[model samples]
Target: MAFTFDGPLLLVGAGKMGGALLEGLIAQGLDAGRVRVQDPAPPADIAALLARHGIAAEASVADLTGPPGVIVVAVKPQVMDAVFPPVARLAGARTLVVSIAAGRTLKSFEAHLPAGAAVVRAMPNTPAAIGQGMTVCVPNAHATPAQRQLCEALMSAVGEVAWVEDEASMDAVTAVSGSGPAYVFLLTEALEKAALAAGLDAALARRLARSTVSGAGALLAESALDAAVLRHNVTSPGGTTAAALAVLMADGRFERLLKEAVLAGEGRSRELAK
Candidate 1:
């Protein structure tokens, strides 16, 4: 993908998400001199990663310099107030401020920056840790189309990118993909336990459970067929798969349970934003 933003990029944190972005950018051929990281006590592995990639990681925000073209805030929600001010001072007036802090709104950044700063709020999933993440970017009214494009380019280097006009939809995004990995992990665990209970050896159960889920995901990703159609393709009439489906779909229990779980996550996202 052709990208226009070429100046310095600053990241405020070096946690999982921040580290992932740095790695992705390096993979995308971003120059080491163009990226600067600000994180105290950076993880040793990530520190080595940045060092190996030739990107600079500073111990203090004061140590970072230059007129940033893209400044990403990847810190936790709880530390936003503490991190934003110094970053605001360092960012250029025309810099595009991108954030992946869950539940942190554009307005929150606006409060700490000069009026009319270009802010883009994003919610990215953990799969970003491995460059298969899905991210949603919502730009504030102050942001221009060019800035939005820059945001898309930066995020797409890691994985997929989508734009949302309504900020309220972020909570829903968080509820779905942001917390989606845990659901899949739980399913994997449950399948392994059930396989073990059904007289399978531990190693066999784990292999079956992991491979089945991963292969299904790979198939879905490579196909144009809808998930419902794919699922139906696997279920034969009066078969064992059908029997399992009957229990899972019975009385709409699974659907309702999933809905409740997403709602609970959405509520917590709102609470954290406060």
Candidate 2:
């Protein structure tokens, strides 16, 4: 589906994640004319981007000749309550409120909006900057099927999109894809450290760690085989990969630790909802 800029799109934040979405949307044929930024102090880069696109930025949501078709809530969760009332005013019957703020729920949006407000809660990871994002969204009952399509279209500008019927699943989604990138980075750091300890030069170790992880990820994404199958394929009998797997997978140590980490993240997400 083509994601035409059926704006005026009210983007409430101009931070890194939000800026990435705006840039991606533009690259995918969204018209900058219909976009506005509500950030009071966007970073210099984002301010320049807004100017380059000829999109207006304001301290508040304002001056649109018409009500916004979509109000993308990209502000931090802590500031959501303060931000919603003004947004509520601009969200007409035709409006679709799509929020990317972590831990902010549909019900929270409902409480601040007019009756029968349509809302979607979405979580997108940092990889969205490079158009490799993974976003999971859940819609309130009031959202129309057309609105869902629009949501999917806009999100697809950044990367892949998935939907879930259960909003509760967001906690796990937040734990996994939302925080998962940091885990991958940590793995890269560990690999680099290990390579250094193994007597490789710092620059070479860094290159090996980053390139190997990124290359493997690209392969995994493009491959038809599942990750386990790919892992097995790479492991020749008694080879280096097998030797490494033995230490990493011994007694399911890696799996257990990863599970624990994800669970802890999920628990924190749940707590934030409160």
Candidate that would win on lDDT = 2
After superposing candidate 1, which stretches have Cα over 4 Å from the reference? 63-65
lDDT of 2 by residue, 55-125 (tens): 86789766677788899989898888787777788878778999999998899889888899889999999
Task: State the lDDT of candidate 1 residue by residue for 1-274, as single tens digits.
Answer: 5556756788899988989988887788777777788888678888899889776677665755466788899988888888778888877778889999988888888888877789999989998988899998899999999999888888987899999998988988999989998999999999999999999999999999999998998899899999999999999999999999999999999999999999999988887774
TM-score of each: 0.96, 0.97
Candidate 1: pairs in clash: none
**Candidate 2, which segments miss by more than 4 Å at Cα?**
4-7
